[model samples]
Target: MITLLSVYVDLALGVVLAFLLLSLLVSGVNEAFVRLLAIRSKFLWAFLRDTLDGSDAQGRSWLPAGVRDVFAALPFARDPRPPHSDQPAPAEAATVPAQETKAQDAVTNLLYQRVREIDHPTRGRTSIANLPPGRFAGAVLEMAAAEEGGVDGLLAKLKSMGSPLHGHLKGVWESAQRDLDRFRQGVESWFDGEMHRLSMLYKRYVKWVLAALGLVVTLLFTMDGLEYGKTLLRDNAFRASVTAVTEAGPDAYDELRARCERSDPVPCITETLSQPALVKVFDHAIVSVSVPAEGDPAVHWNGAAWWDRLTTPSHWPGYLLTYVALMFGAPFWWDVLRRITGIRSRHHG
Candidate 1:
């Protein structure tokens, strides 16, 4: 019974541990994917810039001389930018004349002016204003140079091309960043909530698992007691005693009947023997017959009947101790093992 209980409890504990581990792994994976999604665009931009040697437009272009060609040639390069919808029409740009570039710049300027007219106050505020003038101007010149001209000529021409469209682009970028921050904050809060819920569920599951294990142990202990009782009753001495009594039953009854009929002969023998007080006398008689000659007086009595002899106080302590040990010992050992192995305690309440 003890072995069965231990095996059952161990199996239950293993199941609970497996469940907790699986939950933790799933939670970890979910968190990782959420975090990855949160910064996917930013990381993508950085990767494209580092590997493709191109600006956003160039990186997204689908033309022969675009980032695709550069990335294809540089085997080490990896493009990570999110796919864009309005990449430059590099095929059209390649066909334009040198003189037409100035006209295209003028048209671009006109478009920006129209956009400013439409947006009014929200137009000019840009991240560029937060940058050093030298760096900001250099960035504008580099963008223009990537179009067609050499760096020096691009810088000279940009002075006459009105302010660049960086201000509008910066505004959009900042707005996107703000939205991303809000999204990340929400994701973090959700993760925290999920973690808390998982913790509570884990605790609940552990409690139920432990409770089941305890029940199993209790059942095993009860079974052990029953087995012990069976063994005791099956012992050679006990079986022999029962057999002898059964075989001598008729003679014993006749003897008892004759004794009951005697007068003065055991004064009111039938009445006295039939009374409850006679039980102790019978118990004494049985005890005297059962024990060894040199045995302790406490080991047996001299006047007990079968029932009284079995219920003697002298033998009761051992039975009580065995019963108590069977009922409580397995759980005690299980608890000790759990503690030694650093297993968490289950909370019932």
Candidate 2:
């Protein structure tokens, strides 16, 4: 019974640790993808365009539209309009030209400025990354209140602006009916709900992208789920080492990565991973490994044969199984590993 329990504990620890590491690898690749493509900025821009321009919120992103023309003016978000549409124009319509007097509209200009900085490099810019509901609501209230009639002026402006915001404000205006505070509260709630939905949509997008990246990486590593599990279970020394590392907490990774980075003298892929130092100097890497004519079974994807990599039948099951494990994500595995380790500690203590 004691031996059985110990084996089970080791197995759980090994399995969870493997999954967590794999998930982290996928996330690392995804982070690279995001930076390379500017995915976060694109998503943030999409959300702002939905809110300000009143575009199809779900279909286009979390954003809006005449107000629709705002996306065109944004440097990062290029709406399918004329070249002149890239200039600041009145949010009232999509066709407003650069020469239009509506360019002087204070509210429209402010909103445009704010939306452009939705995700920015500089400070003092309106960042949607961690924008709170109160902040957005307050900005809206401030913009409206700054106008000639205060909130009433803002309401009139939104109504004249003629976008989905007009209807949204109208609903709040009636709902609040008499109290200004209620109107403010209603706007905050509305902003909160929209942000929540935006977050969900972004997560959905991230999930799909991560899965694609994870699959590619799994094949590259030849990470067979069944094979990995069997080896981990059978090798007591490997299991013990993994379990020890798992209990040591998040710092283990930082330490391991740091050590790997420093100790790695060779800038070779077939030699080292987490190649922080090499990537800094070189644009890319080219690592070669020995393989026979029949192809080395040990080598991942069999010596860079794209055709074999894509069409290999035996590799498919391993790739699928491991990829499925990775999709659960690092956070899930981290928590599981932590909890299981805690139980073991308590039992042993």
Candidate 3:
């Protein structure tokens, strides 16, 4: 029973490694997709739109029609329009030029809104993307100074605008007001620090994108852990082979991880398909589930149809488990493999 259980554990480790590999490839694809789709930038723009252009207490957006148009025009931007629309989308909407114009308009409006009180009140606008944080600090201070209540007024306005820095900015403003020169420098530093924090905020959203992509990949591969486990428990020869592979130590898992990490998605998928790391792992699982151990050997392969397994609703729980596991990525699973091996070694000892 110990040996049998170890074999089952080893099989699970293999499945985990396999999922991790696919996840790495999925991650690579997701990174490229993010760039091609400009997902992060769009998310940032949407964030800015929600924060900079204030919303009502009831959550209705107070952003101007033009500003909302700018956000909607972003690459892979969430459509603000209702899903059920009577009017058809314009033909020009399909063209790249129209999208480019909307992107330009968004950039212009965003910068104009930021510095209208300080720098470009009339002239269309400049790109805030390249504006130095020191300069941005100067601009914000100028706006604050222009207000009736000085820094305190700016803090209240910022809070009303839904800016994340309301409390922090208020603290800094109150503490630094006594020493004006020192306060100016502090504000500049604060602006630079906040800008860095903004970039990190976009990175957090990327993890969500990875999770969504991982779920899609898990379903695509039909990686059902429950089905796999059932077969691993039943097949004596297969279990022995997998257990021997695991007994070879950490190097085996590391090699699989390295293969997935270094390879591109197309090549990774191709190589995995051509020569699956575990020969007949899935095939045996499918066969075992479809045919009794005593069933005719030749007909077992015929019974292991791909569609039959893919469509099985019973496999969903396992598929969800696989999806959740994939989010932890390859390195995490490598550590798990090592720990499992250590536990098994100690148990035998």
Q: Best candidate per lDDT, number?
A: 2
* Candidate 2 local lDDT, 1-349, one digit each (tens): 9877887787778777767877898898878765654455545545654444444423443333223232233334543211112233234322222232221333333554433333344223332345578767766765665567666666666556544566777788789984779988998999899878867766776677687778776765666666556655545543344355579765445534443455642332224233222121111112224333365633232345544544668767866887898989998888899899774434653
Q: Give the TM-score of candidate 2.
A: 0.61
**Candidate 1 ranges with C-alpha deviation above 4 Å:** 1-178, 221-349
Q: What C-alpha lDDT, on a 0 to 100 scale, does residue 221 get in candidate 3? A: 61
Candidate 3, pairs of clashing residues: none
TM-score of every candidate relative to the true structure: 0.17, 0.61, 0.47
- What are the lDDT figures for the candidates, one per model? 0.35, 0.56, 0.53
Candidate 1 lDDT by residue in tens digits, 213-298: 43333232221223333333333233343344478765444433444455553344334334322122223333332322356545
What is candidate 3's local distance difference test score?
A: 0.53
lDDT of 3 by residue, 314-343 (tens): 888988877888888867876777686664
TM-score of 1: 0.17
As for TM-score, the candidate ahead, 2 or 3, is 2
Kindly indicate the candidate among 1 and 3 with the higher lDDT: 3
